[model samples]
Target chain A: MSLLEVKDLKVRVDEREILHGLSLSVNPGEVHAIMGPNGSGKSTLSHVIAGKPGYEVTGGQILFRGEDLLEMDPNERAAKGVFLAFQYPVEIPGVTTWNFLHAALNAQRKARGEDEISSPAFLKKVREVAKSLNIPQDMLKRGVNVGFSGGEKKRNEILQMALFEPAVCILDEMDSGLDIDALRIAADGVNALRSPDRAMVVITHYQRLLNYIVPDVVHVMSKGRVVKSGGKELALELEESGYAQFEDAA
Target chain B: MNVVVAKTGTGRALGDAFAVARDRLPGKGAISDLRRQAFEAYERMGLPHRRIEDWKYTDLRALMREVLPLAPQPDATALDRAAGTAKAQAIEGVRRLVLVDGVFAPDLSDLAGLQKGLTIRPLRDVLEAGDALSGQAFTADSSNPMIALNAALATDGVVIEVANGTVLTQPLQIVHIASAAAPGAIVTRSLLRLGRDAVATLVESYLAADGATAYQAHDALVVAIGDDARLDHVRLVEDATGAFNISSATVSLGAHAHFNTFGMTTGAHVSRYQLTVAFAGEGSKVETNGVNLINGKQHADTTLLLDHAVPHCDSREIFRAVVDDRAHSVFQGRIIVRPHAQKTDAKMMTRALLLSDEAEADNKPELEIFADDVTCGHGATTGALDENLLFYMRARGLPEKEAQALLIQAFVGEAIETIASDTLREVAIAAARRWLEARA
Candidate 1:
């Protein structure tokens, strides 16, 4: 069975169906990139697959490792190794980064029937991971993304993804607000988490991030569903030619 | 016994309702004179009815029908039993001085080996000498009728004196336990004096047992901060749901003194806490922060008046209220900058989060500035929780209930985080948690 599967997913937001019967499947160790213009349901797909409420799935199933991901809560799906790096990471004031990450990690661990990592061990591992991502140590003590710059917030998203190392990680516009330096750092952090047992779905508007991430499959989305799927060259072709052809075809 | 209901010249009831209780008060001399002066002030000012602008939210006459005697002596069994409660145990590490029914409970208190620069004594114990206090006499002025009542009827209260150049690590906890089985009002007057360059934290708690109706408590706290001194005061009010609590705290800050007051209000059917801060010296700073969670049909009023009397003084007041059910919460904060009070920086903000359609919060933030060189502003906002934030959290897979709780916790956490001490922060958070858990 495919490690990550979305079968005929239909997500409606505010009575407007944003994701209409979209289906995709990815094997373990495969990196898939979904690129499209604005309002192309690129972000909706990632959010729906992550079990976000309000986006009703009128007809679909999201399977993670053969388990129905949509049936679980967001945190439960997270415990089931499904993670979505939000396009606009929510700023949780008064909740320290260290505290939030610890809670999230331990929640997943508990779901797997594993003992929580000790504070010292968690700190040590978090420090190492944060250092590798070039995230300053003081940021760990501050409120979660409360006053973070756009670039810093993007790096923080990748930092969290690296820390959790979920089986099916979806990065929705993780490269949207980042500079070249921050983009490289974020991509590198994501690349470091790429393992044989894990899969990733990168959602973005531009194909520039595909240069470093090097996805195995590239899908072009327009009007709530994937219109075309191809190899990594598809991203380059779409970047050079734009979504003009897809828009006209639809 | 008829509960004299004579209408006075000002459309208020003026009678000898408290005369018998006043005559029954023990002790004599200057302390008695203080009580008489307070009684006279009460006779003139009387119990604040709806006419008084400050007491508009909590009409005293409507709740307290007649004069109630001040409760004398602590119920050893009751205090002993409450000692085992969860909230009592939370203050184990604090230097506690317990007062039951307005009378000090020495047996239940731990005053041994008190901080080097600190002294805790009862009001009667130090009432022998007029010069015992370095500051002005504890007289009840017309500015506060409740203070007048408390001064007239106060049996006992905690007196704190912090010596110069000393910083106390632990907070001095004053627990005022009200078991108003008696038919009289309970009045408590506390005076806090912080010397030059001294630092201290004072935590006060007002708790009442069940079945104590027609209860009237007039509590007053007068804090005089010396030059360069720092004081942090936290007051937690958890009275009986039927009790009527009207309390006032007047804080006077000297040059370079820093004063911070954080209050948590939850109980009492009609309760009001008035805070008046005067920057009497240059470069003084005053910060007042409070949060009130009123549920059921409870009415809570938190009013503050900050007077920047001197130049180069800064004052900040932040008050928030969360009203649920049919409860009502009122926050009236006024910051006044006097003429020639140059370089005065003052800010006041009150935000209310209404949890139900029937619940209401009245926020009145006013700034009166007469000085050109001062910066003062006041703002108030009352609304329900953000629907967008709730939806966002729910979209993240959190149940709607969990999402609402998270958003609310975050909203109130802003006020809780302003607490300087970690222990106090935890205590406040725990109080908020208890409030949420009861409803959830």
Candidate 2:
């Protein structure tokens, strides 16, 4: 059985339908990539899955480990081991990254009836993870994404995902605005977290990120529905063909 | 002889009970005359209430409808002992000087460890009862009724003098403890003088032990700081229930001198703290920051007046209030730059957070600039906590109540962060946190 199953998921933004009967399923240990052109509803699918407010879910049935996912709030979904790397992350002032991540991780832990991570243990873990990702300790001390560069913001999102170690991770155009070095680091961070019991859905418009973090299955989404599905070679083919064929279908 | 004093709201019956005992005006004939004139000014104005635009949010007229009686002459020794170490423990690392019921408690205070050139004594003891600095800077006889009343009843006030070129490390604490044997009114006064190139820290606290229908008043003055002098002043009030508090401070700054003040009010059924400053020398700066955390049906009002009299002066004001239950919070701030005070930079900001639907917050920020070359602006904002931020925090696993408490503390912490003294900053932060814990 798939770790996350989405059947006939429909999403609307501002009373306008964005995702119409989109369906996909990811079993544990599998990395699925959703490649699409602009306005193909890739980011919308991620936000709808995360339960962000103002996104109307007209019709959808999302199951995580055989449990209903739409019934849970965004944070509850997060606590249930679902993480979404936002396409455009928010800047929260006066809330340091260390503090924010500490709260987020402990909150998830407490939700699962687990003991809170102590400050010392948490700080050690953060330092280790941040060091590996080349993120400075001072950056963690600063307000979350308040003054971070585009690449830094995306990298921080990946760092949070690694820290939380979610069961199902969604990267919504996580490679956008990232330089070559940052993209490599972000891809490495995501790849390091992949396990037999975890699933991931990477949504992107380009095939560059796929070269670093190769996906087992690649699907073409047009008009909120997956129109085509193939193996890893399909991404390279699309890159060479440029998405003009999918644009006509959309 | 039954003297019938005219009653206000609570009536002369209570007024006779709270009338101040033992009026000790200084023998400086000229100074006494000026005091009388100031008192007359207050009489003419007569306790500004909601009718006055500046005092609109603070209804002193409604609060003073009934006058409480005053206690008879105090027992100097008992009052002196009560003002000492017991009071210093409330706030740590403080050099204490206690004023009991508006009278200086000499035996209970400390003058040791004071750096060279700094003098701490009673205001009456300076220059055979009059200091040159107090004569000039502290001599404002405004049309403000509250200032006039404080001047008329001024008796025992501290005289703090910072010698030229000396910077004291610890804060010099002046504690004003008002004790009423009966339900009556009491007034207290204090002064500070920072000499050229001198630096010091001053903390003034007003507290009232269990009392019945008490009224307390305070009038304070701070003189010019010479070029390169630094002074940090903090005023706090914790009064009893059914008590009325009116406190005022007027400060003047000299060339290149800096004055920073922080005020926190947690008590007093109806408390008003008035802060006014005038910049006299060039390149002088002043920043006034205050936080008022009120609960129950308490009423807290903070009013400020900044006067730019000279050129090249900068002034900033940041005040925040948290009102819960049926409590009401008021902030009225005004910045005035005179015609000759060109190149004056001033900003005034006031924000209030209401925790309940019934709680109300009134804020007024004003700026009157005469110089076209200066940059002056004022803003006032009153709103409840952002629902999105609250939801975000709650989604992080903090209980709903705990998340709200954290947000409230962060909002007020912005103002408290301006306090330059780290120890004092910690004290202020802890105090604000305690307020949040109890109320939020």
lDDT of candidate 2 over B1-440, digit per residue (tens) = 55443435443343232233324445366666676677556555666778898788887777766333333345864474455434644677878887766667777678777767878888656524565755653465467777776666566678888888888877888877766546555665676778889998888877765442465545455456677899998877767656778878878788999999999998788988888888878999999999989988889988888999999988888898988899989888888989999999898888898888999988888788887889998888888877656554544445556567766776787788899888888888887777777763
Residues A106-182 of candidate 2: C-alpha lDDT, one tens digit per residue:
87888788999999999999999898788999999987788999988888888887788888889999889999988
Model 1 steric clash pairs? B68-B184, B68-B185, B69-B183, B69-B184
TM-score of 2: 0.82
Displacement of the residue B174 alpha carbon in candidate 1, Å: 1.9
CA lDDT for candidate 2: 0.78
Residue B114's lDDT within candidate 2 is: 76
Error of 2 at B312 (Å): 2.6
Q: Of the true contacts between chains A and B, what fraction does model 1 have?
A: 0.15
C-alpha positional error of residue A172 in candidate 1 after TM-score superposition, expressed in Å: 1.0
